[model samples]
Target: MRKVLKADSLFFYFFISLLWMEVIFRVSVMKQSYSFGILISCIFVLSLAFLFFFLCSFFKRKAGFFLSIFLLGLSSFIYASQFIYFKFFRTYYSLYSVSNGGQIVEFWRDIAAFAGKHSILLFLFFAPVLFLIVFGKKMLVFKSCSTVNKLSLACCALFAHGTGIAAVYAGGKAPNSAYDLYFKNSYPQLSVERLGLLTTMRLDLQRLITGWSPDIELAAPRDSKYIPTPAPSDKAKEDPNERETSGKIVEYNTMDIDFTQLAANEKNHQLKEMHQYFEQVQPTAKNEYTGKYKGYNLILITAEGFSPYAIHKGVTPTLYKLVNSGFQFTNFYNPIWGVSTSDGEYVACTGLIPKNGVWSFKQSGKNYLPFVMGNQLQKLDYKTMAFHDHSYTYYGRNISHPNMGYIYKALGNGLDVKKTWPESDLEMMEKTIPEFIHNLPFHTYYMTVSGHMQYSFTGNYIAHKNKNLVQDLPYSEQAKAYIATQVELDRALKYLLDQLEEAGVADKTLIALSPDHYPYGLDMKTINELAGHTVEKNFELFKSTFILYTKGMKPTTVTKPISSLDIIPTISNLLGLEYDSRLLMGQDAFSNASPLVIFLNKSFITDKGKYNAVTNTFITNNGKTAADEYIKRMSAIVEGKFHYSAKILETDYYRKIFSGNQ
Candidate 1:
């Protein structure tokens, strides 16, 4: 065997491993990444290898080689696990998500199942490690050089890191530098596309150690007069799906905001930009639909793992009735974000994007969340409460829900439900309804658990309980198992409806329900089967049901490109609550201010078209692509929403605005 550490030999093994990792990263993540992105990823991997090689080279060659093998093997495992995770969950993990890493431990069995399914891909991915271990150990060589050579190596590492950042930064475009590209994009799936997985993880680790904020100048829209307010009605050119203008003037729900004065006195430049931005936000005009359910008792649910597939007339009559007989949102979606359930729940409840890496809801317990249904309704003297069917402390809901102005309770606390793999949603309804059903003007929020995954009867209590319900369907076992879980959710809804009717509050209560996310744990084959065919993975897979109804109400259909993020603002608008439209990342779907559904990856669905940020592709609904300028403009707005949403959370922008938290 050759001496183990020739300078080139060390670099050679390091790079071979690094390059293979990149290929796996690309194949697994950045499959659609542009040629430029692939090139940038290559440079990033090389830089990382150089830095690690130099740092570890200070030790004996034997130690260095061993360390190199260990790290390379570890890298292979990381890439493989991440590949499995992304394959199943359809999202990537970030450093921020690691804080909530406890959640993943609960799904170890599911993770293992997924890993086993993708074993072949993983085997190929790690094949290079075997080569490095066998051929590398025998053929590789290294020798300690003079101080001059050591210093030169040190400089080489520095140059590599520096050059890599600069080159990728240039490619990242403004607002998203290489640092932002790698660390703060909030969309890890996209980050892995541009930066190799190792580079992205390295950046993520840096961010975890030293919290990062996007490096962008505060900007005001070029034309401040372009407020998102409705234009004068033109009946001759009405959209086919739009409610015909009654030849009446539209008015806005005017908040007593003095942005001009606020901006003038604002000393902080960031706050000033926010004030300016809000100043120009076009207030969605109050329409006939506004306050349609004002003063009504409200029961808002963030149903876990819900999808349109959950609604079947024969199997889930309650859901089917509500979906067909209420404000059925045809184009609604619940985009899966970084923290899908927690973040999804946060978005629905707080109308804010869960800041990347932190539980925004749990963190909100420390802030003044003024617009949550529990908080907003409590102001109207409604007895507000929130509940979950899991452990009271799971995801720190005990802290977050109460902060949302609810008298919060869950499995371990006030609510008494049997301890099972997943608790019963119906039992929760049975126990909690009496406490609030008779309390007139009450508002209750539920973060439901019945529809949660591990889509098998054996692993999921709700699925097992309702397995026979979906067994007759000509669907795959996994598909049936997934639907069985939702049947329990359906039964839960049935219990809720019966309680409301018995209490004579069925018509008086406004019920709003949407999923925390689609059933991601289920196989895609099952997903396609449920969808009736293969669906567009990006937009359609995220498409879901948002149920808004009051008993005996006329069914109204909305076709706007709306999302879960828009739920709070939409409900607030419907309930006649005053909020600044500009400050919110999501616009009211009922507003004339253009519907935009933002996704985790910064892609968007608007009324006119869809923009896939990963592929950098714009596909118009009309089949003809829109102007490049239009796409760029839409992309900017999407990017702005992401940047400011995170900023809003980090800075407690709401508290600062209302309560002087600055």
Candidate 2:
């Protein structure tokens, strides 16, 4: 009995240590500090140990060995399955639901890429730990067993199996609170169905080996597109033909849609009115500025969390110069997107609005993505490349970038940059510019991260040498800290411009600057305080600065409400690239399409007025009565945009568009 106790204790200690090591690895890589409630993890570790001990005591030696092998194999399989599911299939599953057929292939491809990239590290990290857990103590101890001992071991194994199965089933129904917290906070987009399946699968083997399952509901796939219709209690009794052909029917009570309750023909009339508004708003191309800087290098920088507020006379001279001396957009606005930062980038680069509730960039990986500047320039025999100073895999940029027809490079995977929480944008510029300038007629897209949010001193500190310049700004410590973060970003931009000038590509390279999103994490009070007034929370609050600069071109300011969505079409027009009008949801800001900025909450802004769909209020630059006709018109445009965005995601819209079939 004492020998058994000692062996179990050793096993528990080893397993707990391994778990802790994994925790430490996660913390170090994320650079996030531990706060309170670490003791809960300790308790969990102890609980696992207790269960391990009970199993070892009940099972015979040979039976226990087989049980351990089974557990290890099962866990490995589940982990591998998750990687495969996420990579090849864009859809994730819970224990309760399955992904669609299209998503299944996507999951497979993602796994292949991940495996190809990290197989060696995976084997190195897991193999030694697995070997130690299974075989470490075997070489040190040997014992012979009798019939009684063998029978006892078999009973223990059976008990372990029963407990594991129970645990998995229980866990599927109701996961541990701690696990739920971690899952929700870290991976918000993970479907409940996938979570349930994983919980069940993970616990089943553990419970069979240990003795229990966490009774939890297996998560099922959430049908975001499902619109429920009101039906009789006994829906099965109704004739199928009675249901509307345009609408899909679902079983769950939550899926019920009250289509009959929709406001009558007035809504349709309003939609048509909005479509008319778009037609009335004409944006003519400037024929006077028709000189084409053909075959010139073009550099587009989408700075992270960049805001118009960042532009100041003394603080950001270069930025101010670009804003004042170039073709600056005064009323330019960037509507906050549903997925926000990276998603906004997806819209700007693809010239398509992102669908709500999913990462468009990740979804775009499956279809052909057209890049007006990169792909079109490449066709013109231009060297095209895209650079990002962060993990390319975070938003699945690895897949999306390549699909954009650019030779993509990012930190850790393809490019070398300074190692920091958010890698230095300056370092990225220093390393990448040489590769880009060697040849003429190149187009490079850069996604910068130095201006990311969580605007406190610690969060925004830059590792560059020019950090001292921001100390004299007349602002609060927090505000100064926020500005300091952008200091590096500003410096990075200045450096790139200088390099272009030195290489004599400044005149040849057309530079465009736009923000991915407003710095939302910063205190609104601080922002308002800095601006010397209350910043409107509607569309204007979300407005961003846009700069289009060429060395000697006459600066022309346009007070148009253009969005990131217009970037591709606008650039295409500027570069004289021919594209089918039907290919993009956004029109050229300089073209005949009415310019509109869309917000995360489904509101929109245009030159005429700002419409808040939630409040049903229309506010114009000059205080005027609500224009019912204008409101209806804008609503239809927004609705059409939503419909198209969804269609693009569900169907292969880009493929059809690029192939000239749509």
The most accurate candidate by lDDT is 1
TM-score of each: 0.90, 0.58
TM-score attained by model 1? 0.90
lDDT of 2 by residue, 96-169 (tens): 22221232332343345557876754453355347746674563122334567545555654564455344434
The digit string of per-residue lDDT tens for model 1 on 382-481 reads: 9998888998998778888888888998988999999987889888998898988888899999989988878887878888888778889988888888
The CA lDDT at 629 in model 2 is 56
Worst 10 residues of 1 by lDDT: 234-243
lDDT of each: 0.77, 0.58
